[model samples]
Target: MAPSSQSSLAAKPLSEFSFPSPEVTASPYPFYEAMRAEAPVYKYPDRNDYLLARREDILFVFQHPEIFSNLTYLADPAQAGRVLASKPPGSVLLTNSVLSQSDPPEHAVKRRALRGLINPRYIHSCEQSLRRIANELIDGFIHRGEVELRSEFADKLAVLTICELAGFPPEDRDIFLSWHRIGTGHGARFLTPEQRALQGKDGPEQQAYIEKTIAARVKEPRDDFITEVIQDQIARDGELNLPYLTGTLRQILTAGNETTSRLLTTVMKLLIEHPDQLAKVVANRDLVPGAIDEALRFEAPTQWTSRLVMADTEIGGVQIPKGAFVFMLYGSANRDETWTDPDRFDIERPAVRELNMAFGGGIHRCLGSPIALAEGRLGLEIMLDRLKNPRFAPGCEDERENIDNFQKRVPKALHILFDAQ
Candidate 1:
């Protein structure tokens, strides 16, 4: 995973701008800055889709769900058909049952039913368990004086926490990781054909596993999140449809784990890279929460989310016709000019409520946001407190690899050295 040569996107015109190029995926800020400054409503050449870079346009699109619809699963009927064909007949993937992909009455109903799972008290109640998991992870590698934080710490912490909440068996963690990698990886346009073909196999396998879990949960309910969803669905709809249940569970497992894991990796990488900021958080534990928030703004995990333009509309004075895909570049909006010193990572930065599009905006905002923040804050606090003088392992920074995807940006490995405790 050698670093790709940097592209001079600042000098390039907006019409030529293409997302997901290898150089942009590695580091996208320059291109985003150029887009925001020159063409806030630039149309991508390849897809004829719109890419909104400014905070105002991105937020406007997110807030105006009526104009910009989330029913994007149906945007490409042929592609959707192909995806559904690979799954079992009754699979929920056949239809979009996930929170982020639904609209209006259906979205409201599903969100309400799933709301109890991520309620404030519920997320707070998991603190002790989260802390215990964090310490256990640290304990495993504390004696080594060096460890790869991505796989060894962040990945395990995020997946285990979500799995514990979802009532997934600990033994099946690797299987879920594979499902996440393949499901997320293959969808990226940047991957080579060979890579995409290899990664494509995981989707059907994951769907099969989800189907089996739903069937098992139907017969016997447990104290896990999946069981709660099942009971809620039964109570709401009078009967359990395995397809619907599978859709909800798939979103929870993948979204719940992947976002938090990437956040952990980003926060840790930012903190370690900026030792001055890291020192401040180490001195005052209260700053950890702010640091997590700032890190999310600095490097949003889910970079861009798309919405289908239901009808002809004008956004940022640009006339966008119907049948166009509007890409809300969260990473770009997070660093928009509205925030002072947008590029600088500052834990002390004033709270910019509703401005940061990292968790998205409006009704479709991430439901697991509270849980992800709690996990990140707690994980960082425990690690910073336990690991003495942690820094990148010598020469490891050059060897670091980023998950090559335009939608999500995260390090594949973050090797760090610290004093053995």
Candidate 2:
């Protein structure tokens, strides 16, 4: 938590580049500008190692896993030292899931089990279920004509969808949300000092819950994702132990449920803001899929991901020492001019497929991409169909003005006045 020790180097000072401060966390673009202009790969005078801000450099870190390891913050001696030296064994953010912790072979084995159930075919196969879930949530609040969009719609829709896939009961949505909120830090590092103290608090209780669930599934397995993972060859191989199973379930719930919920809220808000974009999509429903991509590009749900260096690496003309930490700024990467217009929100932007780093590319790319896409498309399509006349509410405690953060972008509570279809 001290200033950069390598101040005498040839690099310019990134002292002015503010990090997770209240203002920066609320709206980070201004700080991102300062950092990108000063040093695309900045070594803050008062922070950790190089923080990649420019698109190309951020992509380089995300794409190259050999030099920059995914499990760095959790595995690196310095970071791990700090984490262990603290009250808890882990950091505010986690790297214990198969996607976050393992490299190559182990990652492949665990991901293969998940990928089999989350493949494109399976995603399409679940379309009817997705549509039903979407409508079910919408139906609950449609007659009311007024609802808290985040809690009632986006959050509920995503949690229910993920629960159904993970074989958790619909009534346990609140519990799933509780676990995910604790795990992902909710919107950002908004956890107070006291909250941060509880990072790894309930280890045994959570482990026991997952064990019981896995045991119940083992006794009489259902045709759901939990049974699939529990009975998986990798699970039988002893790779999915108590900690691993608990972590993986947490990952699926948080990564899939939270990100998709935020992203759905983002796109809905975007469409309402840019009525032209919404009109275009309404006129040509085919554009819903492309609009989902555009929404993802415009406002990525995940803003930051960290990687630790395994060997000395050079990226974007900056040399990072072996054991240095690299913060991959996905939000900045999405706006890279080398890929698209950078700022234009064009739903029909040709599918050049510029490799949006929103999902964390390369080996660490989300195994739930298909599920995210499905949820996004289905969720958006349902809103489009149900709410014929949608616009922002006159005044209902707007969280919009203060949401340009590293974690959750867009207003947490989006009050939209929609005409019933």
Candidate 3:
């Protein structure tokens, strides 16, 4: 939890490695070369699983169900209790939800149900809305010349877009924001026992708040996704219980906000850091989608997602035994040479070769990816439109990996001086 990985390799055992190094997790690219070279399937004396750093290996674990498993691992009572105890247990859906915590039949069922609400075509239709939100946020901050990228732009855009899609009132933004903060806080290395203990309040608080709100929506339904799930199709099967409905909502609220926030933040930070790249996109807004892909490749938001090995498996000469945990170190994979230049953030990067393991692969791939891309594209376009002379703050260069391997920091905070039109 010291967070810096600058010298972690030297401290790590010959066979083991560390993640989210205070420095690396804060800003990881510098340390990735070392991670890729010294340890790909990194063993950590402190953690329960071996971390996969190489792109090929991480993608392999992500796509190969026979070798890696997310269902059992996410539901491990011990893991659940640990993460859950980290905060309050209000919703129970955080642990019991099918999208993030369950596997196979149950995961498939919830995934399909969630998918039904926002089909790929439906997600595409929301592009205009996303663009509108992006423009609104960037418009406010562009003239300020300097803005706190996280709180002002990324945070607001992600939260507002997802909330609108989910049909939550903007007036209740604080409530949903609180829930997301607590859910992500689970296992955050920066927190001490006391701070983590304080976080426990998030559980019960979120459950109560969501249940009440969603219940109201159920009775007096509207045109939102929440209404759709509760009144219309949620009861299609008698087994579609409250927990299931709430669980899907939890997944949407959390996944939708967190990942897209990171994506937008990184895109802004990257554009500022790489002014030339920003210029390319300005010349061709059509490059916005490709820019988003490159940004995801450069610094993916949801860092490492691990799977528990239900059965023994082999990869790259290593034999993973049953019950072992396989961590897909996406941050490391994004920079792995086995894939591409790995370091450069190029908007024109090849499409098929796009480093996609960021959204996950196979059955568990993020159901909301279509929206994530749309949001990122919209957000960056708006930010770029107003950035007259964007540059990193003096001495404020992105210092290390990120706040955590889970959430990334772009330029950390962007300080740009925009000229008046």
**Which regions of candidate 1 deviate over 4 angstroms?**
1-18, 79-96, 180-195
Error of 1 at 349 (Å): 0.6
The residue-level lDDT of candidate 2 at 138 comes to 84
Candidate 2 lowest-lDDT run of ten: 1-10
Which candidate's TM-score is highest?
1
For 295-383, candidate 3 gives per-residue lDDT tens digits of 78777777667677877877677777787777676766666654545566788877523456678777887788877877777777777
Give all candidates' CA lDDT scores.
0.78, 0.70, 0.65
Q: Which pairs in model 2 have colliding backbones? A: 3-46
In candidate 1, position 75 carries an lDDT of 66
Kindly give the stretch of ten consecutive residues in candidate 3 with the minimal lDDT sum.
Answer: 1-10
Regarding lDDT, does 2 or 3 come out ahead? Answer: 2
Q: Evaluate residue 62 in candidate 2 and report its C-alpha lDDT on the 0 to 100 scale.
A: 60
Residue 150, model 3, lDDT: 75
What tens-digit string does per-residue lDDT give for candidate 2 at 1-421?
Answer: 1122221211333575456677666656556655765677887564556778766787677677777776554554775665334321332223334456656655665677677558677678778998998898888878866666877889888888887677877897776666524334222234455545554565555566677887788789898888787667444554434455666776676677877888898898888778899999988889998888888877777777777788887887888888777777777766654454456687887752456777877777877887888889899889989977778878765466545344657575888777775
